[model samples]
Target: MVLEAAVLYVKPGLEKAYESAFQQASAIISSMKGYRSHELQRCLEVKGKYLLLVEWESLEDHTIGFRQSVEYQDWKQLLHHFYEPFPVVEHFEKVDLT
Candidate 1:
């Protein structure tokens, strides 16, 4: 499985709004092919920060399949504006796990 991680720094008081939007946006992504699961976590110690972890079957599933689809535009519209400076997303392959 491929893991996609993003650390979003929402603009101060927009954290609640961002979380609400993410809940709505997540549904769109979940319907895509090869999308396994995802979790949106808020940082308790660091306010306005969130960790988004998404699991995919392959890199192409996200890059080519989902990103290129029309739904992605809606996804961006819903979630992109909340970021202060735009989050950096990185993909990883599972290496060692219990």
Candidate 2:
């Protein structure tokens, strides 16, 4: 599985609006190919910071499958404007610790 993560810094005073938009945008990503699950976490100390974590079957599932699809355009349109300075997304692979 691939873990896609990003730290979203929403513009001040738009936290509630951003959350609403993210909720609406969630459907766009959840319907994509190889999508497993996702979570949006709000920061406790920070006013306009959030953590977004998404699980995919593979890296290509997100980097190519989703990002290259029309759904991504909708996702962008719904949530992009709420960001103060675009977030940087990264992917991770689970490590065997046992």
Give the winner by TM-score: 2
Model 1 TM-score is 0.94
Off by over 4 Å in 1: 96-98
- What's the lDDT for candidate 1? 0.93
The root-mean-square deviation over C-alpha atoms between each candidate and the true structure, in angstroms, is 1.4, 0.6
Residues 1-98, candidate 1, lDDT per residue (tens digit)?
99999999999898878888988998999999999999999899999989999999999999999999999999999989899889989999977877
lDDT of 1 at 19: 84
List lDDT for all candidates, in order.
0.93, 0.96
Model 2 off-target regions past 4 Å?
A: none
Residue 62 alpha-carbon offset, candidate 2, angstroms: 0.2
Most accurate candidate by lDDT = 2
TM-score of each: 0.94, 0.98
